[model samples]
Target: IKGKIKHFMWKCYSGILPVSCNLKSKGIQLDEICKTCGEAPETIEHLFFHCSKSMQIWTLAPVTWEGLQEDTQNFRGWWNKLCTMKASRMSDSRIEMTAHILWWIWKDRNWWVFQQLKRSAKEVVLLITLLNFILHLSYLNYSDSIFLSLILRFSLHNTHTHTSRPIVRCRATMDAAKSPPSYSLRSKKEPYLPTLQSDLKSRRASKADPNPLGVKTSGKPTDPSRRLRNRCTVSKKSRRRTWSFGYADPIHLKRLGMWLNLMIRKSYFNILNTNKLKSRKTTWIGIFVKGSRFPVAIPFATSWDNDVVLVKVSPRKHNVLAMFFVEITSAIFVCLFYRQCLPGSLSPKKAAGKIVLCFSGNGSRAGKGAEVKRARGAGLILADSETYGSLFLAEAHLLPATSVTYKDALKIYEYIQSTKNPTARIVPAKTRIPAKPAPFMTAFTSRGPNPIFPYILKPDITAPGLNILAAWSEVSGPTYFVDDHRFVKYNILSGTSMSTPHVAGALALLKAIHPDWSSAALRSALMTTADLIDNEGNPITDAYGKPADPFQYGSGHFNPTKAADPGLIYNASYTDYLLFLCSIGVHNLSFTKCPKNPPHPFNLNYPSLAIPNLNGTVTVVRTVTNVGCRGPGVYIASIQPPPGIFVKIRPSILNFSRAGEKKSFTITIKTEGGFTGTIEKGEYSFGWYKWSGDIHVVQSPMAVSIL
Candidate 1:
């Protein structure tokens, strides 16, 4: 048997095949009734044996044995009986045939459930018989097993017809089969699988493959290199090509024209037209010391120029052995390591005119440089601790300084210990673009279930925050040290301040495109279109390299491109905000103006949802305005409920007849196992809800704080 068939058998015997009964037993909320017969619960035994469809498949199969229809209690026991059958009744060939039949039955069930395509029992039996014959031939000639497997797989996949187009089978000689297979797509009248050449051409033409033959689609581009970095490019040739596409409707063309016009009017195109701006140079620090082949280039964030010069180490050293053997005057000399180079911690006599080595923690990073400067140290070297991981921050120091990761710090320590005369030079900083695993949560970004209004989520969204290079004041020193006089036109900084501008810039662009949209609508567009994954196609991680939650990342990292045309928006007016304030117990609000029975804070029309005190059941209502196509559109609700919670959405399917049409839905949430009274503070779970349509997918993050 093939590996796939063997694995399927193993899953069946282990009772972990994801049948409805098994899924429900494992805490998944779903109907356990058999999807095929719509009768008995879907179990391993029923799905593969007792169901009417399965029984028909078995009866139609070429192989037969007595007691095959008799109840064996479970799939595992039945499988065990089949394996121990004597050759007189069921031969080894017949057993292999049974496995093939079972595999086909399962595949047919999946097709019916997921793809809404069903095949007759006789068709399934015929396919299994053909597969068994192929396997027998492959067993005789083992070299052709690989080729035969491909044929079996394709045959099984192409069994169901989803379109009116005709399917054609292409044959190859045994010698041709020896080489790798190639595909060629024909017209709709003679539909054939796409070849590699056709696939690449389609990708280059569309810049996207909406219906890849067997490839999985991603939110990010298929090829990273093709992605335009740093700036947006709107060329006339590309615009014309876009217009040529027959699928481009009038609304789409109008939006594209508006976006292009906005881009041209903005500084982005102005800089290109005037050629007044240049790409930033890569900045990094190279540390060169004695007894090393090459200098270690460290990625640093600073607005300083590149200058390389050798410097001597401090002559005054603290020996580790001296602490244990106090009387020993002769000890190996080495540079000292200060846990925190706080004010007055370093002695001027020893630190003067030499680079100081400081560990990161306890004190501010810039303050450490200031302390070294106070002691008349020539430069500073800040070594990160293990907890910091690979995250290095760029700071304007009082002196020439750079930070190194914990791994590199250990190497520096080893060199100082081994070298007799430790001397090094600081290389200038340089810049690098398209950093991987980017758009992550910074350690300093504020997180919350809004302290004052817990039902309203705080830190509404995340953006580029770490090691951001921006214009800076030339009058003040980077570190703002009183005695330090160094200044530059540009500086690299990190924190919520840096991240704020990124979101603000994104909003500015969105506003330019949709001037008629309200502030709340613009915010909704940005939040719903945010990216949850990083550049590396993984969940965005925090500074400590842990997967970030809604509290840390809010809706997600900002994506302006997607925000430009959000399919739907959750709009809220001034009255809505006022009502939200009143519902949250704002005392200053006038009772005469406020509604007698204000809606719950959670019911406010926001892109994201947060239930701060979920003790039992809570139902919240949200409304969305269709802003996509002018024609009819339908969206289906998909929920990834938080752990230990059951979420049920009313009217899971939404239908829109025209643009600007509004629809409302209610989400009812409750604990999985009945209420357990108030939960401990700070205990929460995170999830998301997505409304997927033909052309767009609008997603929103959800956070629930257990009470």
Candidate 2:
């Protein structure tokens, strides 16, 4: 049996007879035709190495072998030459791999013949090469078993690389994983190649081979482009903006969910008109404001020309000013294009100032996605009522000038504190205490009976919270309104919400200069020098009724121009808040409700509370007289004391007899009421009802004595 097995294997290796083929009797011989080619006579050397057709298949293999030179007609010579290649000897291990592959191919061929089946040349070579590589890898990582490695490699190769496409003819049992083998001249001339070509062509045309795995396609594909074009471009004829402003902030989006679709769609509305006035002369060049004419102005200018549309933004809401600033700053990214591009030419002279739509609402509602979407379409956002007040205070503090009145400073303070975050609660109150100074009471009645102090005297100051116009989403109501009122504009929205941004906008202008001031110092300067007068030219006090108290109006309503020239602003420092916190029994403060270790007061993390300190009311005097050229003057000067402090305005109502070159009045302040700590004395001058612009007003030197 051993002799028979050895002889059979040798015959199989030589490619003449299958390995398992049993020729027990001499009269019987192995079938004579090649299993792969099905044409040539079966011979050991013909099947394994010397077949003229089989040798052609080797050309397609990625590896080259020495067998090409050693033999043209013998299995022994082919195998010996392949094993002796420089590639095989240079790496002893590679030599073994080459031998294993040849052996596997022969074995597979033998198995196919014994089973009475045909195997393509490509399949044969693929199996051999794949198995040898796997076996080599296995030997490197683990103990290699020749039999198991060969089987595993062959299984993987067939599973992964067997394409549905038919293989072309090749020689010497090609690897299945390799590309279809190249056939020799004789095989190429055979009828199979033509048949295969015809079948492949039909398959492709019929879409049976449509869009194969890695093929590139040409022309337009079925899917659409990803970037969406602006839809508002359709109606370019219209040149006006009639926006319906909404006061809904992003945080309350859940409450405004039904309006979302409108909000989203409305963001694409027309913002700027591109068409210029036809009559205006179009210049391609102009002089630079600073010096030489680098580039001239041009009409209907292309992007290359230095041109930009300057927008003046106003805060529509209290919180929204900062939010809008942040949003717009981020959206346009002017900084990115500032230096690289040339500036744009100016707009036509008549169109230089277009009536741009701006928003004025609280940041809370304005910052909402829907509102922000609407805001993005506007030219600028403005700070309404109270926001303007707050900004006035900040301006007074930062910018110093001559006629800074208490009323202006106080109003500014009120605006700032109201806009402050809820956590920064520092509402001033006048608690009943001995040595309380008499508050200068002025009569201003509330519309309704004063409700008992509820929720700790909220909304420290009041501003107009009635009907207002704002952005509105078409989603909430009918798309087209039957009545103008039903349209989205001018809906009433009230709160410190509307008032806060009034001050914020003013602050924005001030910030335009000294942008680095801390929030605490800004607040202090605004509050300290405010006048205690009401709009009626009378001292502001609780006598005005309607839940009125010092706590309700921290300082007063803001006046921007007045704030710009405030005489002596109560410049505050960080130590003030800390001191106030200590006074209020907030010792050992920490960011955490209960921190184990509190940072030092001097630490950057420590909060700034710039409140003023009055050692004690000392004699302070100031004199002011109108030196105007003309006036029918009824001047009013009043003192507004700080919370828990008192003041007495002597002859508070100034009645000027006639328009005079000048008139003098004396004002004094005494710490007469509820103040435990040291009080500061300050005086201010005011000329009211002086209608003539020609009148010149001179204020006396104000002095304060602190004991």
Candidate 3:
């Protein structure tokens, strides 16, 4: 049963109990001064709830009743509005405790004012908690829900004052668990965060997420990587007085899962409307940066480091001197769209440094650096025609460029129209931007630079792993979480494990097409074929949603179609792998003989090249096998060297007449003479090597970390 004080207060909020003020307004009250305060007007609310002493008691409470909208003035309206939020609003012990305290305050006031038997307050807070504990134990005598019984058993006491709900304690416990396991945070001198087992008892699982992808989603109860915003650092612990309750009630546990956040704010603006995008996203939507006080926009479009110089075309006529507002209908590579720019009426000779602002619904697929270099545009910016958002552009385009939302473009356009020089500053952050637009790094996704072997990278490739619908046991819930309650034939799961099957499936397809391809050749094909740009045409980012380094996403996202028909493969046999292991100091002297002169660590036949440390000059050797996509294929090299470095490749041209012809090439990297060492700390300069062959344009990324 609910507490007597709480039940009485519920009636008052429900308008059943006649408040003194309403009664007085109806000419029923004999005195106007409150009986408890004597200073304020006598009202039902003031006498029991609004008195200074009642408010003080509320302020002193360890836990509080929150999630109540402050707009409602009357008690009945507020109560009814709160109930309408959920069809089945679960129990909130904190609210009940609040009602009980208000009731006690009213009782104490009556005793002092009418009976003249003044006790300071009706009861101390501990006594009320004790009442709740005793009453909770009583529920086990008749209740039959096992999960409910557990909640009641552990709900007797809580130390979670840091948050409105007990989830604060749950998160803190999970974080502490990640800390050194030798000691427990619960055993510390300060108050410890409580466990989740008790808090989870109150949350009721919904029937199923209404989205079509609901079947493929899973829930995360304790993800330490995702921290709660505005969470308090301090908390209090309930006094430890030994208490236990026998198991008398039982309830079946059910699955609890929700879809991965899409982060797209719901809007009604048509995607095709060039000027009518209405963005509801406000400044308050972003989270606070770690050290910065101000919140940043979650980039819906890729952003660049440089500040934008918003410019508009001259109204008279299309001139080459004026910027070409390119509108690309379609393209396979995002960078390739720049080449599609047609010269305006202005002479091509004077259009060398003109800025081009591209308007597109597909702003996500913006140009990378190499493409910008070829197009020779001074700078570029993509404006979405549908919704307001920034694209989180990661892959560095040589030309300074950024993307803006359709709504923001409208703002820029308005500013341009008003002022002759559109001088609004749009500095989209390259990294450390919020959301990075919404945190995408899930806890289940593995991260590296391998801990054991710091030199080698982990996560060689990545495919979509989040909320994937996969085969499952008939008896299990769709989610793998222990608390999940749903039962379905297929389950939505996420983790490093999900990627394994994807790669395995791709490899199987490749094998079916060409059974003779070696394992290394297959791997090389996948690495080279993988798309360097994301669906948005921006560089793929890490779990944090920030632009990722090579260590995070080796090569890039997988492109299955390209991988299946890779024209050039880095064909490495078992001998190559053996030598790679030897270079890493893996050798057996007693059981197996070790080679004295092992292959250089950088000489492995890998699709991508990474020299961890460069002192001055180093040489890397790579051998590729021609797949005979086009007979008698001729290829020429195109090099994009890192800043302050020069690259040289011996025999820049190669011709292959037969399929499966192997050729080796040597690449030498050397620092520019008399060059000043002025790179950011821990920064790795990026460039690429492209071999334009008769039938294929093969590209390989090169990263150089200066020592």
Candidate 4:
């Protein structure tokens, strides 16, 4: 027996099992009546022995005694009698079985009281029997055939009916279940199972015949004996089918469990991959207020490590208070509201040595902080407007400061209104590593389908843009305020300016590794290997928390790790670019003349595909060069077609013999109907095509529009 079970048994013997009577004796206020039967006061003896439910379990159990009724007066007496075998014969297995029965009985009672789940006496007995059998198998070495025969005999005995069929059929079904099915990888047909056919036939026959087994059925079996028999003996065919489904073989079940465990492990690995390239230097702020249990943690982009504790003040809108003397803390300070915290608006006499709260807008975020510093304020809190949503930016401020979302600002406002005297402290910021969902598209990220050249996809890729900590110039104030004099060596900033360096750095690294590859090849490597899923192993979402598409994320968030080994890359030369420009009606170049018949801009061999106008059908060609993989490699094509569009590939497989080998494929896209307006107006339908091999998966985004 497990240590927990032994501990439970010891508690039962000591009369310290927390029964209702014992709880009442301990001064807990409640009726000490039997919770199961509810007919008598609930003592330990009544609960374990005299209760009608417990009595039914004992009767249904295989073990019994003659003087059990007399010993039931007290639990200790009954336990002593059972252990000494004064009322009945006792063996090691029989004693163990009794302990399991008692444990399950207590568990059932608790389940009924707490979860409202009620189990019958016969169900409890069946569970105990299975538990004992498993324990027996673990300790004793038994042959497979012997174990099967024992199980069959127990099942037949419980049914209380005799059948003439040979037991060999059951053994054969169990054997079939143990063996795995055989099928070829290239075969289209699934391997067949004989047991499945038989099971299906049995189900059909049962549905057609009201009494398939020639036994009368009842709507609800009320008699205890009838219910027990009905539960045990539903059908022989069903039992055989259950065994055929791998229940009879523990090894088969173990393999299935292992496969499920592996899938869960893979999912966790995908989530962890989101933080693979996260920066080590980052900073976040925390606001600690009096009377609150936990300090509100605010993730900020840039901040100064200056701590301050002062009385909080929220001045009335546009109200300037005259200087008044009050004895509270080190200084007497006044707070200015959002619009009143601007440059030349704050009265230095009233705002000195205080933290100012300013809402973002009338000025830049950093400008607000700079204005607070000009007034000799100790710190600043820049609250974002609703337009910013959950996105927070890092800005170089002239003073110790942090920015908060509109929602968190509301919480701080409420605290100020409810408190008699509000006091707050700003904890100095420090760097934090591996923030979750790191590469989400910022609310301010530019999205598009290329207004000038509709055939070419815009915003080719994404990278870490929000809250990036980078080196800063110390020549000017952090906020660039003319009067501000503060300087910092490092600062956090956001936007395309920050994201551009990330991609540039990646390109430099790839170029250093493969010095001969062109810029187009480098871009293709990044776009094709980008990740479409976020940290939680789900599709990446936009600022509004909806699943983002190619327009919002381009080819997906940049993944430098996978980009280093992109198996195939799409490359275009200068002439191809000129042709693309000519096809898009940009043929004003003085150095080159336009070709009489220029290739369509969509056929420029770009990493991504975009068809802004698909009147009926369009076929585009693309070429890829195998630059990474060695030896002969074969890749199979898989397509996730855009909604309301049907796409076909000329050749669904690519075979390459060596590095630098090129292969070309054509994609033909058409609407289900002859015309193109099936999807919502002005919305582009999205899809993807992947070329997968044993080692790599090369993917490209596809966008389609009706107008």
The model with the greatest lDDT is 1
RMSD to true structure for each model, in Å:
28.8, 38.0, 27.2, 29.3
Q: Give the TM-score ranking, best first.
A: 4, 1, 3, 2
Clashes of each: 10, 92, 30, 1
Clashing pairs in 4: 282-431
State residue 114's C-alpha deviation in candidate 3, in Å: 99
* lDDT digits (tens) for residues 218-335 of candidate 4: 2211222222111111233422321222122222222222111100000000112131111211000000000000111124332212222222211111111111111112222224
Q: Write the per-residue lDDT of candidate 2 for residues 373-438, one digit (tens) a residue.
A: 322321111222322221110100000011112333233334334542211111111112221111
What is the Å distance of residue 421 in model 4 from its true position? 3.2
Off by over 4 Å in 2: 1-462, 471-490, 528-552, 573-576, 587-707
lDDT of 1 by residue, 397-464 (tens): 76666676667666666666665655555544444444655766655433554455567664466766
lDDT of 3 by residue, 656-704 (tens): 8888787889999977686686866445676778788756767777777
List residue ranges in candidate 4 displaced over 4 A.
1-340, 348-350, 674-678
lDDT for each candidate structure: 0.57, 0.28, 0.44, 0.56
Query: Candidate 1, which segments miss by more than 4 Å at Cα?
Result: 1-338, 385-387, 406-411, 418-420, 590-592, 629-631, 674-682
Q: Which model, 2 or 4, shows the larger lDDT?
A: 4
Report how far off residue 319 is in candidate 4 (Å).
38
